[model samples]
Structure formats: structure tokens, C-alpha cells
Target: MTQEFGSQSTTDEVLAGVNLHGKRVLVTGTSAGLGVETARALAAHSAHVLGTARDLAKARQATSSVLEAAKAGGGSFELAELDLASLASVRACADRLLAAGEGFDMVIANAGVMAAPFGHTQDGFETQFGTNHLGHFTFINRIAPLLSAGGRLVNLSSAGHRFADVDLDDPNFAQTPYDPWVAYGRSKTANILFAVEFDRRHRDRGVRATAVHPGGIRTELSRHMSQADEEALISTINATNAAAGLPPFTYKSIPQGAATSVWAAVVADGDAVGGHYCEDCHVAAVQDGEGLRGGVRPYALDAERAKALWVLSERLVGEQF
Candidate 1:
């Protein structure tokens, strides 16, 4: 039976009565913000959570609260080093997990960078695209076999996917000028597409993938934005809503923002939600328009595009399954 949850739901509230004992889950970016809360909540429910960060020392310090939460709930917490911006680091992390030969019940691709200044990853892909999409793409695929039967993959996408679809011809913007938000939107779109295609290829293997828009929350993901950037973002949001005849934007608290992810990862029925994008703790509608008010863009869920991206990503990462 499918349960109905909403935007106001908290992580604990949504996961209430769900016993995750003996379940092993992997969560990225658990040093702070949504990732930390996500790990905390799952661990609180007696799941063994392996959380990742770029720097192990910093992650240990930053995730002290997660440790406390896990202790309180009699759950296990372990930290791993993972830097999505570096392919070598991604491989190293995957190697460790693969060597362990243990499988995870769920893997949450929750780490990502937001609108940042133009830069390239160590491998020379655009920062946002590289770190957000390609990085996770490579990491997840490499570790995919480690996902146990009936496992779930929850990708953390964003509502910003409405900003722009990916430019397959020029993902790195070699010719086109770089617009931070546009790049972010494209990466987010890729996130959704990754889930769509991943589910298609792996669902028969009992692995299901879904993308999630965790809602707007004040978190470190926006640390790259300045005061002016925030105002401009708000202005763009209000303008978009006005065009859509929708209500003004309202930000969600951290717990509220994480509701949908937790829902997708643990509470929701995997088969029903797989390959779909979710927000407000529910499946988001596919709305093709010039507004970021709500819902996902149709292009983000296009199966053909997802397949095309999967091919392109394999070529770019120089690996295939």
C-alpha cells in the first residue's frame, strides 16, 4: 500500500514506524545540511548508514550531530572519503566499497554543488555539471553492483531543472557563455534523466532509481550565492510565479526540505516512484513552461534524452557497464 505524505512532514515523522534494522544505506554530503539530517534520520531508524564527504576529518567533525543521533537510536554510522569533483577520488571511494563486497539497501546521491562561478573539475568538465551529474553518474554506476537486490537509488535533483535542459552538443559551454544558474539547471535536468535511464536499465535487476527535489531550504548549498544573488534569485522566483499565476515562493525548513528525499529513499514504494521526480513528498507533475513555481519539466523525464545522456556520459567518463 502507498502512503501519502506532504511538504510539512518531518524526516522522523515520515519514517515513523518504519524499522530499518539490518538495512545498509549510503548517503553522500553527510557533513552538513540535508545530507546530515538524512543520515541522522535513517540511522535513527536503526539503519546502518555510510555517509561520505570530500574530507574525512572535516566530515567527522561536521557530522558529530549525526553520531549523537545514531547513538541515541542504537544505529551504526561510518564515514568514507569521497570527492565528486575528482574522478580519481570517486574511483577510490568506489574501490573501497566494492572491496568490502557488502551490498547496500539504498544509495542516496545527495551531494551536489549549486550555482558557482565558472570553473572546471580536475578532469576539466564544467564544475556544476562535472561535480553534480557526471561525478555521481560515474560513482553510482561503478558501485551499482554493490546495490543489493530490491535496492533503491535516490538522486537529489532540484526544481531549478525548469531553467534549462542540457545542451548535449555543448555541455561544457565551450562556445556558449557560462551562466551559473543555467549550468545548474542543466546539471539538475541531468540528475532527473540519470534516474529515468537508470531505472529503465536496472529495474529488472531489482534496483530502482528516483530523483527528488528536496524543496527550498536555507542550506550550505547556496553558500556560493551572495546577498545580491539571493535577492536576484528571489526576484526571478516571484517573477516566474507571477507569470504562472501561482502563489509567492515560500522556503521550507531543513527538516521539511528533506521530507521528500526520505520519503523516496525509505517510506515510498520504490516501484511506484522509480524513474519519477518528486517534490513536496509526492510525485511532481511534468509541467513544460517558463516558470520555476513547481513540478518538473517534461524534457527532464524524456526517455530518449535519458538514453542519449547515458551514452554520452559513458563516453565522457570513459567507462561502461
Candidate 2:
């Protein structure tokens, strides 16, 4: 029987009775929070996991549990240095993987920053935009040849994307005022759009790409936010939920946050999620709204916009996919 999963499903629960003895998966941001949990769960299921982090030292210490799980479950776990804020680092990491030549069944772009202060990446693009979107864009495209024919690419996006759409004209916010939330939203939207176009480009080769919202989880992604900032965001969301006669907003557990990613990568039918946006372990409806209840925005999945963003991204990164 096909199992039913929901907002609170844990990684172990999602993988119940499913054996992944030889599947190879690449997950970014294994240093903490959802990334660590994601790697651990996959490793627990005997999936060979290649995890990346900006700081190998910190990721090694944080993912000691992943190593243990891998050992116990007859899987393997390895880590590599990847600083998404630096295109140099991203290319170097991709080059190393390409040189290794082992194919991956899935590439989970799960690393990201949220609501960070105004700044630029090593490439001079806005911090969130460059790190979250362009970095992965270049990194993943660079390693496209290594994606197994039936492989899937899952980008970790968020409901925070509701805050804004991509400003193709001024992605760097040179003339306009900068709001951390807006910048994050643009980056998250880019993640979904990137997945959309990527799926279109690679589906003929049996590779698919999709983006997912992991829901609200108290993870290191929120490190940039102050207590007041977090509380205020919660208050705003809860107020909207209350007005809509919905349950008060609550944060998902780290495992819950990681579940949808694994579900999209391995369990969900590839055709169902390809070029789509998901949340709560299912393909979310395209809903236009002010509240973060649980649906994708129309703009986030626009094909034309996805194509436009893809072109823009290539130009910015000085590479062609």
C-alpha cells in the first residue's frame, strides 16, 4: 500500500519498510538542523550520502550522528567543503565530484540562509540571492552530467517566498531599499523557478527537478533573526491563520522539516513532483493569498519566468548550462 504522509511525518517514518541499499544521494548543508537530519535519515536507510558544508570541520562534528547511522544501517556517508556564497568554492566542489565520476540518484540542494542582513556574496550579488539561488544554480548545473538518468533534483524553498517575487531588473537591490525578508523571498522564488526550468531541460534525459517548502522549523537558517524578529514573524503568521479560522501556526520538528525533502527525492513519484512545488509531503496547490497556510504562489511556478530567471542566472554566473 502507498503510505500516507502529512505535515508532521518524520524522516524515519517516511522511509519505513523502504530499503535504499545502493542509492546515492547528495545533500547540501550538513552542518546542522534540517541538513544534518536529512543526511542522517537517508544514511539510516542504507543510502550512500554525499553531504556538503561550508566548513568541513563543523559539519564533521555535527554529522557524527550521520556517520553512526550510516555504519549501523550498512550505508556510507562522506562530506566535502562547499561555500555556496563563493562561486569559486562551488565550482571547485563540483569539479571534484565530476572527477570522482560516481553518479548520484538525487541532488538535494538543502542549504540556504534566511533573512540575512544586507550584503553581497563573494560574487557581489545580494547575499541571499547569490548564496541560495545562483550558487546552487551553478553548482548543480556544473555537475549535471553526474545525475543518473532517473535522478531528481530537490531544492529547499520556503513559504517565506510569499514576501516577494524576483526583481529581474534589480536583483541586487542597488536602487531599491533592501528588506531582508524580500531578499529571501526572491531567492526562494528563484529556487522554485530554477527547478521548473531544470526539469524541462533534463526530463528528456530522465532527470527531474522540483522545489519544496520544509515548513517553519527552528533551525540555524534563522540564526540571522533576533528573538523579536522570530516572534514577530510568528505573530504575523498566526494572526493571519486566526483570521482565516485556521489553527495557530506552530513550528515543525527538525525531522518533520526534513521529511518532505526525502519524500520528494526518493519516495514521491518523480512525474508527480517534477517541475512542481511541494509542501507537507504533497504537491501544493497554486493559491493566491496573503497568509502562509500551505500552497505555492502562482509566480513561483511560472514557466516563462523560470526561463527568464534561468537566462539571467547564466549571465550573472558567466556560464551556460
Candidate 3:
């Protein structure tokens, strides 16, 4: 059974009473926003956290801040290089980790770009699809060995996935007009599908995976959004929250936004049950409507689609496992 912690629950609250001494955690997109919160919370619990970012210098700065906070709270942290937009970078980062002979108790695939103007990664793939989905896909496969049995993997997905399915024929936007929201939706869907397939393939090995949608929070993640676009989204969210008699979509603080992820990683949920989509500090229920205003859409939970995407990903990344 899953429990719902409201938007008020902070990462520290979600992680309350859990002791993580000696646990090794790796969190991507750790330079800022919820990523930093995840890293900070983990480290604060005595977990040795390795945070990743695209820019080495920026990552160092961010790591320093997190480390300072961790130290203040009597915790520890480290930094690493990981650019989700570049497969080469992802592979290189994985190689570095492997070289260190370090084993991770958890790998939090939190790095991702949201709706951004049309662009491509260094690999010629569309930016959102490449960075949000493919890079993590390749990264996990590359470091699958370091994930000790019973290790956890968490993928950060979004409610925006209610918008679209993967366009297998044109995942890279090579033949079709690019819509940033649709691109983001596709990538987020890939995140969920990835966890489903990953759980299926690796659960027997005592490994498990989960996907999460942290409730909306204001953060630097909106940097790519236009002022108009941001205003529009905020209006829509506020309207929905108001209708629900909720607090006008103030939604979550950064620590709150990172709560569900921390909970999923450390909770003793009985033997690494995988392929679950979580939100608000618990596994979310599957919904069946199109244009789902809230909650996970059916398409995101479809087992068939999940498995199919796995095959497609394996083909794209050229990895046997």
C-alpha cells in the first residue's frame, strides 16, 4: 500500500527516521533546483552523495554549496560530470565512475531538460528526447554493473507526459515540426517506460526501478520557458488547484518537490518492487482519460508500450543489456 504525503512534506520529512550511513547515492541534474535538494537531503542523512551536472565548473560550485550545507548538518558530498544532452558525455561519466570501482546503493536519474526551443544534442537527437530519456537510458545500461543487487534506480518523470506518446518514426524530430511540449511529453513518457522495462529485465537480479512526478515547483528549471509561457502554465495550474480547493498551485517548495524521489529510494518497500510510477510520496494510481488534468495517464502505464520502448532504446543505444 502507498501513502500520500501532501505538498507540504519536505525531503527531510519524507526521509525522516531513515538512517543512510554508508549508502552511496548518485543524483543527476544536481547543479540546482530539486536536484540539489535530493543531493542535500541524501547527504544530510549520512549518505555519500555524488552529484552531477553538465558544466564541470558550475557543478563544482553547486557541489560546494551542497557540501557546505551537508557539513553544516554533519553530512558529506562529492561532484561528478554528467551532461544528459550528450551521449558521449554520459558514456564518459559512466567510465569515470567505473574506473573508481565505487558501488552505488542508488542511482537517481534526475537530470533532464523540460520544454525548450527546438534544438538537437551533440548526437543529432532532439534536445528533450536526447537529454531527458536517451542519455539516462544509456547511462544506466553502461553502469548497470555498479548497481549492486538490491540497489535502487529512480527516474524523474512529469505529469506533462499526459500530452504525447513516443513517435518512433520521428523521435529525433527529423521529419516533423517540433513542438516543445510534445517533445517534453515524449521524453517524460520514455522515463516511465524505461522504468517499466528496466524493472522487468532486472528485478530478478534484485534490482528495481521507479519513476516519479514531483509536484510543480518554481525553480531554475523554468529558465528555458518564456515569460508568457511561464505565466500561462502558472495560470492553468492555479486554476486547477483553485478548482480542487487546493492552495492555488503554490504546489511545492524545492525540498517538497524532491520529497517523493527521496522516499522512493530509501523506503523499505519490501524487496525492490519495480515498475511503479510515484508522486506525492507514494505510488500513483493509473488513470485512463485523455487530457488528464491530474494524475498519471494510462498510456504512461501501458505494459506493452513500455516493453516496446525498451527494445527501441536498446536498438538506439546499441547495448545488449
Candidate 4:
């Protein structure tokens, strides 16, 4: 591990002396942004990378550089089709991987949607909850058998989780008014809780799971936001920072954004990261109340809350792990 790694670190810098020649990693949403950079970094370290995306063609095109880098580094890169919003697609993808009998050393659930207009997934849950949390929930649990012992699961959560905690009673906003930020917050919190529960369930087999915040990065995940909305959000964030005597808000580049994911997955100690939330290449502290500068909220890492959500998720998905 790089003792100096922090918010400004890039994926390559964190992995400078690391070798992954025989490792196999599964990274979702490799069609763009941090996913692409993450896959490239791992592959460059000679790790076999199996990346998934909602659109196969798009993924292939986006990952061309990754493939070239892998070849040069004596690694490999491949793509699989996966639509997180569709249970059928998730199941099919898992089934195919199982049938192929290939095992993975790590799974990075990087695909997710950001703030968007109110909507539902094909499975009838709110869009953000479905695609960001539930979809990965069903998919990862189904493919649990494929993860080798000592393997890791890295769920890409967000600092936005501070916006709100999970609303178990109204996850779909059924009786509650829908707000994009709130919905996003709920799903991101679920991401952390999922990791906490999963780590508990699988640690006996030497498998560990953790959630990470990529910090703020400009990417396709923000496609749903209008320019005006984006400006307003940034202004608000900067204002909040100014009040706290902290520096103004700034976004990390793709490599910098992805550094934490790879760091948590490959560099950080297994025991230290298991069931924890990380940001800026290190485990984040539990923070509560207003203004998301960094750190996770307590509710997201509550063990009891994690267990309850797992039960609720199984009921919603109509299947148990």
C-alpha cells in the first residue's frame, strides 16, 4: 500500500508497485468514466478484467484502450452484457458466468444512475433504487459462488448518502413524494449496507466486501442533470464548503475518482476494509448531519439495518441467496 495515497492519487499511482498477473476482476459499467479507467489500471497490472455494461457495443468501443493495455501487460479484457434495471438481464449474465465456470477474485459494482426524474425500473422499484442497489444486490448474490476465497466485493456508494438514509417503508416513494437527490441518497446508503451485510455473511469463507465513494467526478452518471441544475448544485456545495473553512468544491479526474475503488479492492487490508465505507483511498469515518464534505453516515453502516434490508431485498426480488 502507498502510505501517501490520498484524494489526489490516481489509479496508476496507487498501483505503481502492485502486480495482478494471475488475478481476475469483474467490473460493472465499463462503458465509460471511472469504470473504464479502473479496468485499464487493473489490466495494466496484468489482471484479467471482465467488464459488464448495459450495452455491449458501447462497452466494447469504450474499452478498446483497455484491451490494448491488457495485451501489452500480459493480461486480458472481455465484456458481458448487463442491464442493472432489468432482473432478467442480471440473472442471465450471472447464469452465463456460472456456466462458463470462471471464478473472479473481485467484483466492483460500479454501474449506477445519478439524480434523475422519478421513474421505476422494469422490476417496478424506483429507478435509482432498482439500478443502483437492488440490481447489484441480486446480481452479486447470484454470482457469489464464482468469487474465489479471499476475494473482494467493492460497491460504489456516494457521499450523497448523507442526503438521506434508506426509507425501508417507502423505498419506491410509494406514499412519499419523490425527490431525485433523496432517491439517490437512499440507493447509495443501501450500497454501503449491502456491503456490511455481505461481508458478515461471507467473511467465514475469507471473502470481504466494502463500499467506496469515488469523490466528486464529472461523468456520464450526471447525464440526467441539466446544466443549470448542475451549476446550482456546485454553487451550493461551494457555499457549504466556504462556511466550513474548507477549500471550494473541486471534481476529481477519472483516474483520481477511480483510485479509491482500486485501492479498496486491491491495496487496503482485507480486515480493515471489510464491511466499511471508504473514500479518497482510505476508510472514511462515520459522519452525520448536513453538508457532504466526506465520511459515511452511521445509519448506512448499521448492522441491524443491513440485515433488515437484506430481508426486504430478498422479498422484493422474489429470491433468496
Candidate 5:
């Protein structure tokens, strides 16, 4: 069936009449917001969902609604512990999944940290770059062997990638001054590049990867932002929109915010969407301006840059994938 869902499409709407009876899907950061909504919507279509959280108890509590939805849809739900800030925790999670020997139809790299004060991960990389990019990079690569043929990998990138491109020479900001938003942007850009290279390497094996920009939503991911930061962000957004001749910024409801992600994960054609950055349920155009509402930047999807970032990432993480 040919489907034409869009930015306003709800998760349930996208999956309406679709059957995922035996599909195995893994979604990270299920404790709240988009992750919870994404998992619930998939489960509501009878997909077996494995949702992760840094705190299992909180995840179980947060995903109670998901369990209820699963019950209603005759789906199943399970939980796993994951802390994206620690490579050790990432390895443990991958190890557990490996031991299960069960392959997934889809894997969604949905968990992340937003703009925060300068800090380092347990492995000593910049907090945002390490947790949002390298952490998922390591985990997904380790679990790549467990993806079923034709499986989909969805990395949740952001429109914030326009803030900065990946810095291959100093990804951790050891030499340069640390700027929270810039670091976050670089990490998000890495998310897109990771998907780009991943598609190139794995598409021949029937696996496809894509990055998604879930529209702006008032989620916990913004907990670190102070009032001043919020104001500055709004100003930047407005200026960018004005320059682009677009409307002022608007936020999506949690369900609405998750639409594109669910679309990329389950509804969109893998080959058509693979290696691209998507927003509003379609492959986004390349817009160069910073703080623009709805498109990816050219650098984010460059194949050569993707390859270079992959090599640099492997070296930084000290693991050859």
C-alpha cells in the first residue's frame, strides 16, 4: 500500500491498519516524551518493543501507558537498562541483546542529551558528543549483526544540526572553547553522518539507516536550558525564519513531534529514505542557514565527510567497527 503521511500524522494514524505482529523493535530513552510515544505507537500495531532507560524502575513506570496500549493491541513490551553517557553501560546493554540472539526489525537511536554545561562522559569525551553520538555509534555497531535483513535503523537527529557541523579535528573541544549549543549541534550532525555511512555500508546487506528531525517539542530534553538560553534560541529561530521567508517557530504536541520519527521507523520505504535526513515525514531539503525550521544542512549528508567521521569516531572510541 502506498501511504502519504505527513508532519501532522499521529503515530497511531501512521500505523493504522498496519500489522507488525512479530516485528522486533528497540527504542532508546523510553522514560518520557518522544521515546515513550514512539514505543507506544509501534506496540499498538502489535510490534514487540524493547524500550530502554537509564533507570529501569522509572522506565517501567513511565511506560505503563505503553504496556496498556500493547495490551489493547495484543503486542508485547520489555525493558532494558541503558545509560548513554557511559561506554561500559552501552557495552553491557549490547552484550545482553547479543546473548538473546534475537534480531530486530528496527532499531531507533532516540535517547540523547541536549545543550548542557561543559562536561565529559565517563569515557572522557564531550558530554553531548559522547552521549548523543559516540554512545549510540558504539552500541548500534555492536548490535548491527543482530539486525534482521531489511531491518531499519532510525537515528533521531534534530534541526539543531544547523548550529554547527562535525569538527573532525577537535570533536571533544579539547583545544577550542566549549559552547553548549555548538557541541549539541555537532553531535546531532554526527547522528546524521552516522546514518549516512551506515546506509552506505549496510544497504547491500538489506539494512537501511536514516536520521529524523522530530519537530520542536517542549520535552524534557530542554531541562538544561535557562530562561536566557530559551530567549536566545527563540531570537535565533525568528531571525532564521525571517531570512528564509518562513513562518515563526511553532512547537508540536508530543504526539505531533514524534510523527516523523514513527514515519521513518515503520511507514516510509527504506531505500527511498535511507541515508537522508528527514523532517515532517519527508526527506528534508538541504538548507544552509542556521536555526531554520525544517531542513538538513548539506554537510550533514556528505558521503565523504560521513566516511571521515566514521574513521575518526572509530579512533576516538578506540574500537574498530
Candidate 6:
């Protein structure tokens, strides 16, 4: 079964017949783009959605857009605070949710920063690794109890994982030269490793985890890259497309890009199979080429590496689950 969808599928299409009237869902980075769309779609299906943003004000603004969409489709939404760069913020957000004692049926670790300038987060870790991986790691650890039985986790990774593997020796770039793209690549790979380990450790507890590469889409994720870098990437993509006898287009719309993440998180069929990397709404076939479409790299899917990262993450966040 080829469950792969194209760049034209909307959230509603991806979720056409699915319903979650009483299920609680949490979406991070809901201020815009794919995150906002995911939240809107879930809310439209009557799933209680808590969309997290760095600030409540911005989150509300984002929620308003989802609310408008939900009004037409029939559902509701709420806002929460989550600053992936700050462990304290992650703790606070988890605490707030836990205080409500509202168990969530799903958690989408969706908020992420892309190829930004070299910098350290409040935790003294590379910004991409810190926010995209560590933040979600800490949040999941803190909210382990809140994940209702049979809950699922969606870690949004990227095709960029092909560029590099998790640099356990220098995750923070503490002693190495920092290349923003490399850092982003490693972080994306970490996202997959996270799911691999999360599933390994938590499947027995009735929680499963997955990682997905929602195909390339135009979004704020590339904001930090210079025009030249983007052009170079586009050029590379175009060259590859041309070689494959395809068009020059390399990006998809927000809704199209969000389809796979939505599929992995909410699809009833997905519950039986977790810890796999997905693309276009289905478990990705392990690829082999090094130039373009490749399988999850050995390191990215390594159980040992995933476990090591999990241990390191627990130490950093002072939380264990």
C-alpha cells in the first residue's frame, strides 16, 4: 500500500473521515504555518486542541485564525505557552498542562527553528538542537504522566537528516566550528532518534512515538538563511529534479506539508506501528541513495544512540520518565 499523498492534499483531506470529538491534542509552534494548520484541522474535528506559542498573546492571534477555520468546519481551540529554547519555559508549560490534570491523547512536537545563525540557546546549547530536539525532549519527559494510555507522539523531522547525523560528541558545538546547516541537519536527525528511543522505552506503557518528514514547504523555517543559501539549496533541488525528469518546484504549501505529521499523529491505523519515519502520510521506505531520497541513516535510527541521547536529555532536564 502506497499511502503517499501529493503536495496538494489539505489537512481536511488527510483527515477526511477521522473524528476525535472528545480527544485532547497538544500542538506546539502554533503561531503560524504547518503548526497552525495542524491545530486548526484537529480543532475542526472537535478535538480539544491546546496550541502552544512562545507568548499567549501571539498564541491567541494564531488561535484566532484556527478559530475562524474551526467555526466553518465545527470545533474549538486554546493557547498555551512554550519556549523551546528555554528549559525553564518547557518545565513551566508542562507544569501548567499537568496542573489541569488534562490527559492528552496526542502531543505534536511541531515547533522548530530552521537554519539560523550560529547561536546558543538559554541552555547554552546550539539553537537548533536546543529548541528542535532538547526542548521537546524535556517537555515529553515532564509530561510523561499526562500522556493518556494509547497516546502517540509526533516528532517533526525533515529530509535534511540526510545531511548529517546526531553529533553526540558535540551536540552543543562547544568545541567545534558551528555551521548552521549542519546544526539543523543534526537536530532533525535527533528528532528521529528521539522517537526511536521514546518508543523503545515507552511502548510497554501504551504510548508510541513516531518521526515524520512533512515534505519541503515554504515556511518561516528558512527565515534565518540568506537569499544566497536558499538559492543554492533551490538550485540543488532543481538540479536533482531535472535529473529525475521532474519540474523545478521543490516546495509545497503549508497544508500539503502538514499532511504527513497529521497522518502519523491521528490516524487510527498508525497506533499499531510506531517508531518509524513517515513521509507523504505513510511509513517511509528505507532508501539507499546518498544524493537525494535516502533511508533513515544508520545513526539516526540506532537504538543505542537513541538511548544515549535520552539519557543525556534526562540529565540536562533533570527529569526522568
Task: Give residue 101's error in model 5 in angstroms.
Answer: 0.2
Q: What is the C-alpha lDDT of each candidate?
A: 0.92, 0.95, 0.83, 0.95, 0.92, 0.83
Candidate 5: clashing residue pairs, number: 0
lDDT of 4 by residue, 1-321 (tens): 537689999999999988999999999999999999999999999999999999999898899999998999888999999999999999999999999998999999999999989999998999999999999999999999999999999999999989888998999999999999999999999999999999999999999999999999999999999999889988988887888788999999999999999999999999999999999999999877577777889999999999999999999999999
Residue-pair clashes per candidate:
0, 0, 0, 0, 0, 1
Candidate 2 versus the native: TM-score?
A: 0.99
Give candidate 1's error at residue 146 in angstroms. Answer: 0.8
Instruction: Output the TM-score of candidate 1.
Output: 0.98
For TM-score, candidate 1 versus 2, the one ahead is 2
RMSD of each: 1.1, 0.8, 2.2, 0.9, 1.1, 2.1
Looking at candidate 1, what is the lDDT of residue 247?
78
Tens-digit per-residue lDDT, 16-57, candidate 3: 777788888989998888888899898888888888898878
* Per-prediction TM-score to the true structure, in the order listed: 0.98, 0.99, 0.93, 0.98, 0.98, 0.93
After best superposition, candidate 2 residue 160: deviation in angstroms? 0.6
lDDT of 2 by residue, 147-259 (tens): 99999999999998888899999999999899999999999999999999999999999999999999999889999999999899999999989988889998899999999
Give, for candidate 6, the lowest lDDT window spanning 10 residues. Answer: 287-296
Overall local distance difference test of candidate 3: 0.83
Candidate 4, superposed: residue stretches over 4 Å from native: none
Inter-residue clash pairs, candidate 2? none
Preferred candidate (lDDT higher): 3 or 4: 4
**Taking the tens digit of each residue's C-alpha lDDT, what string does model 1 give over 227-291?**
99898888899999888777788888888888888899888888889999999888898887786
- Which candidate would rank higher by TM-score, 1 or 6? 1
Which 10 consecutive positions of candidate 3 have the poorest summed lDDT? 286-295
